[model samples]
Target chain A: MKIEKKDVEYIADLSRLELTGEEKELYSAQLGDILSWMDELNKADTSKVEPTAHILGLENVLRSDLPEPFPDREAILKLAPQRELDFIKVPKVIE
Target chain B: MNNFETVIGLEVHAQLNTATKMFCPCPQADYKAGANSAICPVCTGQPGTLPAANVKAVELGVKTGLALNCRVNEISIFARKNYFYPDLPKSYQVSQFDRPLCEAGSVEIDLKPSGSKTIRVARAHLEEDAGKSLHALGSRALDYTLVDFNRCGVPLIEIVSEPDISSADEAHAYLTELKRILQWAGVSQCDMEKGELRCDVNISLKAAAVKELGQKVEIKNLNSFKAVKDAINSEIARQTAMIERGETVAQDTRLWNEKEQKTVPMRSKEMAHDYRYFPEPDLVPLRIAAARLETAKNELGELPRARKTRFMKDFGLNNYDAGVLTSDRCLSAYFEACMKEAPPSAAEGEAKAVANLITGEFFARANELKVNPEDYLSKTISPVSLVKLAALTSAGKLSASAAKTVFAGSWGTGKTPEALMGELGLAQVSDSVQIEAWAREAIAANPDAAKDFKNGNEKALGPIVGMVMKKSGGKANPRLANEAIKKILAA
Candidate 1:
């Protein structure tokens, strides 16, 4: 599968990323190379193997439904670029 | 110029009543708390944060599916739905895409004046909720929006209904029954006012003469069931008018404006976001064991429809009364508890008596206290006390009028019916001797009426009975008082 410039532009727009013309061309070639490598990997016969979502041998890692207090309130709020009276302010977002 | 048929499909988002966020340990506390106070690094979308699924949320999703008679899948996958918004801290939601938890379920909605209609549920998928963007639209000082991550990472299940609904009333009934089922299964609170339940409606109008469907328009921000019905109704009208005017209806997203009572366009179809969905790498496939599935099915308990049918068949309650009793799970449980304690011989009568107390006086008291009936039952009243009150009214030990007084006074006081009755002097004076004395006094006082009564004037007996009731401080059972008055008059 070939990744065209338009496809890269559409993906960048979806991700809310702004890319220059040169960078868009660069990513188009880079993404196409990545896809060709994936195609090469797909050529091998792996039909007997099961599709794996996670490679780790981990399952059912869960926490009980008991709640503890959130320890760092002020620090979390300060991480935001703009803050007003314990709230994180951003550009107005209408529906 | 042409008759049209409306098609509506609803998508409902129900927040799970979990103790913490779906992927993090941040407490899902009330949003009224200080903003950012409940934030954790994982929920705040900090880099290198890994998310783990909540077992309780998955269990709740399964329970809901079983209650709706859906086919629960043994394996489901979580996918990353990538999008960008201020409220979505992670810029993507962990949601079920190709594989959902439940599928192929249907709900039965009762229609007016006739039979019930079945709405097909396409699928129900588990997802994490986004935070809310608090907008300062009308304020003069700040015109920017604020972000609150308190709601981020909360667990939710999105139920998508097929386009089987033909009218607004049927749509409303579908949502109402769905909410009741979820609440009964103890899956979610399903409270619309608290944003625990939200709905989005998709509607289109097709000419009755044609078989093809028209362009579909999506409506959002419906905070209540009534809003959903109104939005669908008005959207149908708007689309029908457009077609009549020889204009094609444009597919768009609209918001329900409660003040104007109309749906206004929020965005056009061309601006729709492309959610690039891929399998989530951080979480493993959720595998439901056969034992776990059996446990969920057993935990569903008696659903509303079956319980309502039983109340009608076994308890001999009418349709409307049974529906009112089974509407709330807590109420039905309370009634069943009362029935177990009622006298064995008069079980049907006692059940009706308890139902009346709950629907009548109990509802009124709960309204006055500004609490939900179920909450009131747990906090203010006890089922044993309620059964005893019904028993008193049934055995003729308490006058019906005095029962009302005792009900009002006993709310939240932890006083039993007997204690309240004793303190208020509401016990019935059913002694024949005392009743005869009052009847005799009334007879002697009114010589003219007494003579008329002895002359076989049965209507004249009413005044004597009234006087007897008044002399007993209105504590005499009116039926027994009437009988005693007749006996005295005949002698």
Candidate 2:
């Protein structure tokens, strides 16, 4: 796969990141290198290998459906830039 | 103008009734819980936190899949649905892609006024619920949004339907049947009120003669079944009008503006979302063991359609009555419980009578109590009491009016129907002498009607009966009063 500047820009926008002209060019080239490397890696013959979602080889890492509150809920709630009461405040998201 | 056919497909998100969220052990209990209260590092997307899948969620998914007759995939992988939203702490939702846990199950919806259609189930996949975004604060005091992450990691199963529904009514029937099945299977509560079940409707209009489909418009935020039906109908009208005006229907996302009763564009085509979906690296592929799959299939009870058919066949109920009886799983179970209390063999051919009481007065009382039939059974009236009431009404010992009184009283007070009837003096007054006196008074009060009745005006008989009922203060057995009035007019 080839990486383009517009693709990088679109990805950056989707990630909610603002990119400068220079950073966009830098990321575009960096992504191109990363993609070529991935393509080179993909060239290896592994036709019999099963597709994997996780590298840990864990098939079913699960927890019982038991609810427990986070120990430091207050600290976590305080991490948001803006909060009212218990809620994290942000710009209005109209549906 | 052209004749157009409306085609609608639905995507329903039903929150699994699991104790914990999908990827974390945070309590799913408090959607109303204080924001971030239920958050764990994994659910809130803290740095370097790993998610462990909730086993109960997958089990419920399998159960739902089997109930819907979907092929449950032994293996399914979780993927990252990448999007930027403040409500989604992870910035991407963990959902199933490509390989879903269940697929290709169809639900048969018996449409009202006649006929049935099989709606093809496209897929049902498990995912996580995003936290609620509150814009009420923006409209209230400040121009800002509030987020509650209590629902952040709650597990959800998204059931996507094939575009087989060609009319708004069919779409309604499909949702109704799907909700009932899921609810009956104990997979999810499927309550639209609390957002347990959410629907997004995709619809488009095509010329009846045209082979290809038209531009698809998605309508979202339909909170209730009626809203779903109305939204589809309104969207169909809107799209049909747009096409008739020689205008191209642009693919856009619309919100059901319930007050306006029309869909308004929420996002234009240019602002459409591009959800970059890829497998999540944090979680392993979900594997359902053979034993778990067996349990899921075995645990499913009689589904809504099967129960409805059985109710019609076994109890000799009509289609409408059977449908009403089995519409809610709780009600169907309650009816069965009532039958057990008064088994059909002992019911003296009044099994249908018990069904009538259940679908009629008992349902009304249940609604009035604002409790489901199951709760009503445990809290207010027992199945035995209900069966006895039905039996009494059937045996003519308790008049229908008296039975209705007992039914309502039983809900208000915890007393048995017979006890309530005794305490409230609502028992049918079947004393022949007392009924004769009331009838005589009724005949004397309406001399003209009596003379007309003797002259063979059967319609005049109603006035005398009405007078007798009024004289009896509505406690008189109506059938007995009618018989008494006929005898007096004959004499």
TM-score of each: 0.89, 0.87
iRMS of each prediction? 1.8, 1.7
Per-residue lDDT for B1-491 in model 2, tens only? 24997788999999998988998888886555555678878888888889889999989999989988899998899998877788888889999999899999999987777889899999999999988888775447557888888888899999999999988789888888888888888888887888998999999888999999998898876789999988888888888788878999988888998999999998523334788889988888888889999887778867888888887887777888888888787788888888888764773367778777776777666677688555856766777888888888876778677777787777645678778878887777889999999999999999999999899899998999999889887878888899999998898
Candidate 2 Cα outliers beyond 4 Å, as residue runs: A17-30, A41-48, A91-95, B29-31, B138-141, B267-273, B346-349, B404-452, B459-491
lDDT of 1 by residue, B1-491 (tens): 24998889999999998998888888886957767778888888889989888889999999988888789998888899987788888888999988899999999999987689999999998999988777753465467888888898899999999999999999999999999899888889998999999999999999998999888898976889989988988888899899999999987889999899899999534236578888888888888889999998788778999999999998889888899989988888877876777767766778888889989988777777787755755765677788788889988889888888887767777789999998988999888888778888977787888888889887887787788788889988878888877777676
Residue B193 error, candidate 1, Å: 2.1
lDDT tens digits, residue span A52-75, model 1: 666775666666776766687787
DockQ of candidate 2 relative to the true structure: 0.69
Candidate with best DockQ: 2
How good is model 2 by TM-score? 0.87
Root-mean-square deviation (CA) per prediction: 3.4, 3.6
Taken over the whole model, the C-alpha lDDT of each candidate is 0.85, 0.84
Candidate 1 regions exceeding 4 Å error are A1-5, A20-52, A68-70, B268-271, B366-385, B405-437, B443-462, B483-491
Q: State the DockQ of every prediction.
A: 0.59, 0.69
Model 1, C-alpha of B178: deviation from truth (Å): 2.1
